[model samples]
Target: MRRFRARRRQEPTNQMRYSSATDVPQVVPPPIEAAAGRVTESERRTSSQRFRGDIQGLRAVAVLAVLGFHTGMPLLSGGFVGVDVFFVISGFLITGLIDREIGRTGRLRLSRFWARRVRRLLPATAVVLVTVGAMTLLVLPMTRWSSVAWDIATSALYVVNWRLADQSVSYLASDDAPSPVQHYWSLAVEEQFYIVWPLMILLVLWLQRRYRLPLTRAMLTGIAAIGVPSFIWSIVLTKTSPGPAYFVSTTRLWELAIGGALAILAHRIPRLPAVWAHLLGVAGLTAIVLAVVTFDAATPFPGIAALVPTLGAAAVIAAGTVGRRTISDLVLDTPIMRDIGTLSYSLYLWHWPLLIGAAAMWGEDNELPVTIAVTVVGFSVVPAWLTHRLVEAPIHRAKVFVRLPGWAAVLGVVCTAIGVATAVIVSLAVPKQPSYAVGGEAPGAAVLDAIPAQDPDGRPADSVDLLVPDVLAAREDLATLGGEPCISELEGTELEACSYGPEDADVTMALVGDSKAHQWLPAFQRIADERGWRILTYLKSACPLARVDIKYEDRANQDCAEYNETRYDRLHELESIDYVVTSQVASQAYLGPNESQREQTDAMVEDLRRTWTGLEDAGRQVIVLVDNPNPEHEVIECVAEHGDELSACAFPRAIGAERGGAPAQLAALEGLDGVSSVDVNDYICPGDMCPAVIGNVLIYRRGSHLTATYVDSLTPRLDEALIAAMR
Candidate 1:
């Protein structure tokens, strides 16, 4: 009786008897009878299911791997595969429960099932969201608050996955720091599956009953219908757009479907011999461990690579279902494992925000202490245990939900909705102080005239009001070409030449290179307007005008190289072009392999020399505006956090000018005809230090690019340099 048995009854529920006085003979069809018998058996087996310790243990392993990966353990770099394991387990358990429900009753209780899910998940989730919202405001910079608030709101509504997918693709948002609530994206994916899967099952069950199809066969067909296409799409999108593919529900559905398939066919699967079961379980465990160690950030993920761990998890589950005790079952069935498994959901929810909050409080450069990390993880258990005991346990134990009046249930739902809406409103309503004055005298003219005497170490005595109501918005204003169609973006259409300045100006000057070159456009545009000169701009994001090939995110930038070549050829053909101005992030240059910093710098200088010499040879005057000091962190973010005392955010001139300065430019322009190099390093860095604010203006918008407001202040200085270089 304790032995595992299939859920089939030996006898049919209803029997047909032959009548003694029969005008017509009564016949029993064997096929119809057998089908009826099978359905009855399935129903019986479904009602007598036992708890699976192996599944609970599997949950423990999955959560541990995820926790390790998130804690930045180098050995568990690929532990993200744990999510795949979780998906499979979820699929198996949820499908099993639903199948049993359908077997016992003719219809699925959609409302009751969903209510259980909401009660189990939402209460704890809302608490985490609220806690994260408060922490984000207190610990993180105001610059991040707006985004974090929206993320929290979306996480509460269980749609953060789509938001994350959108953000992953946005170039502007690419450099944004991770949110405290970012882990909720995974929960969002699972919640979405919960919403759609039951309806799908309902449809399948209805079809099976109406069409006289076998229940198991019908369910398998439905699962395959969704799973197969999803798997194929996952492969396609992972190759083409890995960022979005990684987080989206569609790409991840097949992983869950694998578990569902196993659950549906559990009865049909043959039991393995003891030796084979042990071997399979061990192999499954090995595969999971191997994936965690071997896979890294560079690995093309969740594509063919994902099959390793998913199949491994599937194998372990399958092994546990049959034969003698498997290695996985033995290892995973311990009391501690079961307890951790019970607390897995809450642990998953609590750990991420704590880790992210730690990083935000202490900058990323300073790793959280191992002891502190352990302590924090330990502390997370307090909340996890409390949440499980106080919220989750009570909800599951109370069958009163089923007996509650419909109006009472409706009121509970309404109240929950109101609570979530209120949290969102409160998060969004947090006020930010305005820092920068808008509509002042021309920032460039004012700063240039007012810059105080340099300190003994060469730092400027004057501090600028870089802090604004919105620093990012002000930084966006720095680029006159923010939305210009001609500025090529990644995957943009064919490049077109763009022109600015006076339409009928006699003299033509060209500004060309990456975004760094584009940043100088506002200053040059002002010069052009003042002097009746035509300005032609050829700029692209992350693409330098240098002759050397560039690499981004470990891939060769073929588009950048091609654009540079084509643009160079076009520049040669432009007869009216007199002056060619160029600048770029000098440190980004890729010299061959194993090159030291000096060697790379030298190689970059040589590339610049070749490009500038070509321009001069073509009867064009070359003016190289030396790239600005590169700050190691976002200047605006620092200014936002430390606006009252901007010096706290200042970096030494030695570090700021490490990449770009007079040395590199002079080396490139040496002995070159019709070419000149100009640098305002003295003004930019002041002396020993480069402060975030200079002369009441924010110096840099992001890290290196001068804020348009700051650049406006530098026009008088820049004009003198440009006029001298041209002469």
Candidate 2:
């Protein structure tokens, strides 16, 4: 899973966007002699099936675009548009099938239609789930097992899209890795459509029969009623909360409805002249290509931007319907394209997990080479072909419950049960925290001084077993800082204030900044409790207290600027505030126009000087706690994977120094009166090498923030510094 940061939005993978509907074969006419009204096997086949060679080719195009995008091809940054194409295709085929059935027979066979869908899709899906589940336990780290298992379970139930939508907006799971089954969200959306659409058609047909209304009119009315509101909601939500809007089903229904409307109006649409058909086909293909090349992760999606691809797909389908031989018919009907289309469903299922599993086996930084990615995609054919032959074909061909016994239905139930049970057991077995003997005294200054320095290779000599629990449970430790309304959100500018310590204490010390300031709350609370001092907290997620504006997701963060102004005014109004403490991750700051790095540094120093001078003029003391060293990678994940040889996770002090705290703080507070700066980097990165563990404690939780357990151990040193600053 890509880490979710407010400024660095991770683009969703292909699985969240791509799904392939199987091709329905053309049916031969049945002989007369059956009952006049009774539906024969041939009549049922003809009603529900069409051999659209052009559509098959389109499936091939959709899957390949998704594959190219996922494998890191620079040319296909907008490869995500392939999903829009898929939605159009799904709407067209499904609507066409339903309409044909109505034309051939007076009433729809809802039970038989659903049964066919199960045989066509479920068997292969179940097999893939079981295989992926087994691979997850064997290949992925223990930390990811629980999340993946739940994803698998929900995927089997066909409701994982909703789960992903919730996770997308959740602050707690923001940095969670992508699940192997994350791709199932798109499939879930399609399945939801499959279930609801038939019922909607049933309603339309009943109304048409009861009132003697035209079928096409009724169908069009039903589609418009659902689609119009959904499109409006999609536009609004994409601006407000893109993460959830991208995964939720309702936001995407309009694209599918476009295809459904096309299918209903296919006959009424005029037959195109050869020149016009050719031009429409070429233009449509061009639009799709342009969207794929130009769009990127930053584009506001499934809103107005989605029109490029969805409308393009609709144009191509419409062109092919009227023309004698359009470009799609002639070019897309090749052997390779048809074969790939035949295997598209299985291929879509297999590709994503393979990519995720490969990332897990290797480190996240290792870019999957083009050759290896191609080979991996090629290897997918084996499982895909096997699944199609051994599972999908057998179930569909068995014709069980149609005319034969109910063996196929029984088999489907058993497979579903097995899949559910496997997911449950695997999820439950994942340990929340590693087993470590839980008794360790907090190391005081004397104890810290006695610890041995790093070896020549920069590896710590002490045992790291005590830190295992903290590493395994880093997220829990991070939660000690109150979340949500207590601390302002990343996009929020609200001046929310929280307090700790005795309410009646005379001395009131205020802590303010972004998350970096929040990290020190546990230690500050402990110090306040011991000394009977009151602690006030005003913290935001990504916003720092610096006067300079910052950018988030490629746009200026106006909210952060507003929050800083409000906080400054609030601080000035509090006459009894005796001390102010501030710290922030300086690496998050960026320069404004005409501001060079040196100029920005000078500007920051001036801002601090002004703020500190104001406090001093008001007779209040200020302390600047320097930010901690940020590791090059996620240290907790590194520690979890390399517990035996923890030295492998040690980051060079030179690199940490270049990227982090000391220089920035020294420059900002140089020669400033009434402001005292304190750095704990010596304790964190002892002997010029920042090992993952120090004094048998995990140093940093996610990237730079100190774990609450480690911060608790730093109480003595922090107390000494604060008392000296006040004096």
Candidate 3:
């Protein structure tokens, strides 16, 4: 025991200094018997070294899977598993390198390792980022520029994964176009792994030496105990909040550990007959292929489901190149696979930007032909090879690579400056958005005028709930406007609800509907104040005021239907309401049983017509404001996402019975006696495409939803329509 302890102590040389791989000393094994005496069965088994082409082949597989998936190739639907494969490969390679280094020298060179990795990664990254930055400025709309710039900066720093997670771009939300850098999330994961993994290995190695512990035994024990719990956490977290699972590095650490475990056990696989080796390799390859074929977005990620590909990779790696040859070996070692493997990093970096840039320049609807894809392929190869040859290999080979303090600082500063410059350029090029445009008027003053104003003594509305308080900065400018917040949080649900004015204001007018009518509120408020109308608002986000019950995404929204019904009942009980005003888009989806699209729409129209007719029969005047034409951009996204395409953001003025037709829906009200339809199409859409911004206010706050400013601006028009309808 004492002799064994002394030998273990002698293994880690204090003289071994922290340095680059180039400076790493050669390792020689002790005599087999003596080494065995010093090491345990588990330790020897755990620390074996075996070369596996399957892993490299696996790399080829992963990259191909990802590339095919991104290319929208029909055969590669499950190509997303490529990232999982990469995770396993990363773990294997990193662990192999660390374990081998520790076995040879007893200490790990943390800085030099990181520097080589940075050089390997950063050069091509810088090139792609600069290229994408230039292209974003050249073709992207001004409104999108800011976000693109911010994303570029984050990607450059390897922190883009966190930012994207925070943005909550649902993994399933299949927007036609995605950002070019969206693929960087995986790169970020890899980079983060590189940052901490070497240190972890070093700590483990030091602990092994200090305690006279066998290295392999320590690693295996640590991995099993730590890795299993991590895997469980990953599953739980992924199921609970996929957003966090996607973004958080901690959840993914175990995937790499799987590869690390394989590295620790590489040499122990019983030497199999050539036929068995070939069979195992073939089986492993088939498993991977099947996984790639069947997996999809709905599949739970990085969980136990990930093990199929991971274990398959491990099996292939275990079936080494020597002694047994499989058809997979021939395929993987083929020149094409090898070349793609060589260029994988570069290909990954370039493909997304090329695709996205192409999408931005042309629309996403167009396909990138073989020529364009090949052009992207060409661009990827040249730069990647050059970066590997020039920056990565040479820097890694240099002795200075190990001893550089100022270099890291200098590199960081340069990266920061580039990021800042890119940001400023993007910001300067993007147009500034003017305030107030929510539904389709000028942002500031023009929107205000566009709002409908009520005549004095019109007590049709009351004060608003949660009106912008004078104390809050956002509310300061709007304080004089004097309407309730277009959105009020309901009690238990804490969801935003829209109500007209104070419930008891002598005269009552209900501002009821989806976000579109919400946009028309400023105009309604003006009319209410002048007419002394008590405003009663009943509204929900994305839930239109149509009485037709509806389903959302196949789920019944009984709460929404109930909410509307209750609000209507409250309005019926109101004592002072002399007039009823309901405004909403006609094409809104409703939720309920027996609520086919047509039925829901017809039911909504009938409900509104019935309410108006009932009010008229009760001797109360009834006026209906025709819903505004919907813009392609949501009322808010027009402000937030598409502010650059100001014209594209606006509501179309053309009146028609086509889809999203408010005029047609309102026209149905014509036959209802004592109910009048007030058309605001002229005020909203003035041309072919509905403009998101008229004078300058963002017409919609998001997509087709109107901003409070634009909603506030509709006072005059709403008032005019009411007066005309009442007359």
Per-residue lDDT of model 3, residues 372-395, tens digit only: 554564566666677656654575
Highest TM-score among the candidates is held by which one? 2
Candidate 3 or 2, higher lDDT: 2
Residue 635 miss distance in model 3 (angstroms): 11
Q: How many backbone clashes does candidate 2 have?
A: 2
Find the candidate with the highest lDDT and give its number. Answer: 2
lDDT of 3 at 521: 61
- Evaluate model 3: give its lDDT: 0.55
RMSD of each: 10.9, 5.3, 12.3
Candidate 2 structure quality by residue, lDDT tens digits, 1-727? 2221111133445453322334433221111111123346565455335556666777777778777777767677777777788888888777766766665665667766666666677788888898888888888767667777888888888888888878765545655667777777778887788888889888887787689775567779998887888899999877766777788899888888998888776654434577777777777778888888888676777789989988988887777665256776666667788888778788888887787777667534424565566567778888988887787777777745567435555665776676687798778768755634566743522246554433344446445445533555775576353332356765555799987767789889988877778888777878888899988888877676767665444334566788989998878788768888888775434465345767666666666678677766777777888887778777777777787778878888878776655466667687886688777666667767788776677777766777777787777778887888884
TM-score winner, 1 or 2: 2
